[model samples]
Target: MALDEAMLELAAGGSTLLRFYGWEPWCLSLGRHQTAPNRLLGSSPDDLRPGVDAVRRPTGGRSVFHGPEITYALACPARAWGGPRAVLQAVHRALAEGLRAVGVPLDTVQSADAEAGFAAARISAASCFRDPAPGELTARGRKLVGSAQCRRRGGVLQHGSILLEDKQHLGDLAGRDIEPRGSAPAGVSGRGPAIGLNELLDPVPDPRLIVERLTDHVARAFGSPAAAATSASAGIATSAALTRLATGYERVHRSGAWLWRRERPLPAA
Candidate 1:
């Protein structure tokens, strides 16, 4: 959970941050640094089927994929950045604006409840791209972007995903009988078409394009195009902290006991 520890450091130090990242292969990422066993009862993630793997993200959100999509991480003081909602909207609003600049129209879904919680059990499908939350961008009623956040004592770190391509092997990944998602409007009923960068720009969209536009947009959103810093000199420079964070993740995230926390354990000694 690099994002989680990084948020703690940034909040403690009072720094604003942003990062663009991608997943290796096709992995399923869960929320709040949770593991697959915690989500899927009795499911074995050891073999990690050819098309499926899982990782626990520091942010709190439902499961999402690491394929043909763009992901981002940001950390900053809550006071420097707006409150949770404001900070989230700040990023999504900029993303919506940038996509619009490239000719892709989207709608922002605002939450009236604000307090209604998300249930993971109800959403076991592989398509996290279909869910919507307040300030999340959508096409008609279908989701195009999803985000989650974990606020620590100091600042907050938020991470998100934006669909860049359709789930190529949706059936094999999530399972058969899956509904359409991401740039596929065939069975989506009255939902607006999910557009991608290829549809907006003459050339196909790539990770680099997303990073460039998002970096600029985020800077502008903070009203300090110059205040935003993308250098690693800020926090990740500390070898000790880096070692601690890495160790913590390896011990908890990759460890069998932590990953399979849902399993019943023998009585304590």
Candidate 2:
């Protein structure tokens, strides 16, 4: 979350970045404007599932339980990617191309009205995985990818999660107090019925290989002559400037005050 925000500085300089990562010990991430359940927030490890915690993501979307999943973030100018919806389709199409390379029959949902679908999702769903807004990948008619975007300082950062396992993670929604999101209209979203890679393939492909294919496809999608991978922490942790900026964002990510609302701004790098 911290580094993704820090990369906005590089993005402002006209650099495009595609990052694939995962959560260690797993986590429940809330969208920029989303709310976390009171019981779940600040709960001890014993009070919740093992090896689980929570944080507010720099991007916008509903809460997602990230485990046995691959998370990707793309940061660049909105114009470079066309727009949020254009970026969404391009990234998802790149992901589909990678899945096809690995022999997974991928399906995509294209909403008759994407903007309308997402607008409805903002109020109707509590989980990004709950609905396939439009242009999301799917398997067996169930959602496979979920994403959202947030623009800061003329740079757009889009974050997405690709589920790799079928485990149901009712993380923040385990409490009985929260009401169900309920069903959407026949054509409406909010009932994605997500599936994982394992369910679509006899044996799931290696995570590194998935990352590589995704990188290549995305680079091609964005018209890169040659795509090269970088260490996740190459500049994020080593560069003093980025380190300081990331630290500030980290403070905001962990700050309880900013969890329910997006009052804190992303400190400039």
Candidate 3:
């Protein structure tokens, strides 16, 4: 979270950034404006499932379970991308191309009003993957990538999870069953359910390959030139600045006030 925020700061200073990462010890990250999951707030951390931690994201959307997935964050001036939605579409388009290059056929979808409504109604459930949003990526009609964005300080920060494997544990943690069902719930639109690379291919490609392809495609999409440091000494000054910025953001992300700021009374079950 802090690193993403730091990227936003970098964008504010006129530097575009693209990053790919994975979570360690697994985590359930809530959208910036989302209500904390009741199940999470009520249970003692020690009593919660092993390897799962909770944090609030800097972007908006729904909660995402981070495990067995590749996560990416892009930061740039909002005007550079024309706007947040445009940025999302452009990135998704590039991702679709990149994934196809790596042998995973993909498509993009924008959630309709009805689908958005369905997702809104279940926001309290804190399940991001189960409710595909507009401008997200899908494979075989199922959601394959989930993303969200926040625009401020003349810059935008967009981040998302690309599932590499099913996140059934997220369902267990939320106390909800998100297993794909044949029939849609009453009043709900039927979209291909959330899916992962494992479901689309015999052997999932290495996560690094996917990241490299995505980085190349995204750089091309933005028409940005890529540069590399010539030597360790050449990167020392820039690296130190990033380290300082990340340290400050990390402090905020680790604070109790920010993590539990949206706590609310659980609705009657």
Residue lDDT tens for model 1, 1-269 = 44445445545467665666665555566655343532233245443333345666656555665566677667777777758667776777787876666556676557543224333324443445554655577765556677777677667777777667545234222444322222322553222333334434466555666567777887788654322333333434444554455455455556555444433222111
Give the runs in model 3 whose Cα sits over 4 Å from its true position. Answer: 41-51, 108-122, 168-174, 177-192, 225-238, 262-269
Pairs in clash, predicted candidate 2: none
User: Which regions of candidate 2 fall more than 4 Å away from where they truly are?
Assistant: 42-52, 111-115, 172-192, 225-231, 234-241, 260-262, 266-269
Q: Tens digits of per-residue lDDT for model 3 on 1-269?
A: 87677667767767677777777757778877776644554355323333346788887667777767888788888787777666777888788788888888776455444224334544455467776666668777778988777777788888888888767344433554332222223544322367888888778888877877887899888776222122222332265555567678777777666676743212111
lDDT to native, each model = 0.55, 0.67, 0.66
Evaluate model 2: give its TM-score.
0.81
* Candidate 2: tens digits of C-alpha lDDT, residues 85-185: 67767777887898788887876557555545666676323567766787777778888888777776677777778888733344435322222222112
Off by over 4 Å in 1: 1-4, 33-51, 108-126, 168-202, 223-244, 262-269
Ranking of candidates on TM-score, top first? 2, 3, 1
Q: TM-scores for all candidates?
A: 0.70, 0.81, 0.78
Count clashing pairs, candidate 1: 1
Best by lDDT: 2
Which model scores highest in TM-score? 2
Report clash pairs, candidate 1: 11-155
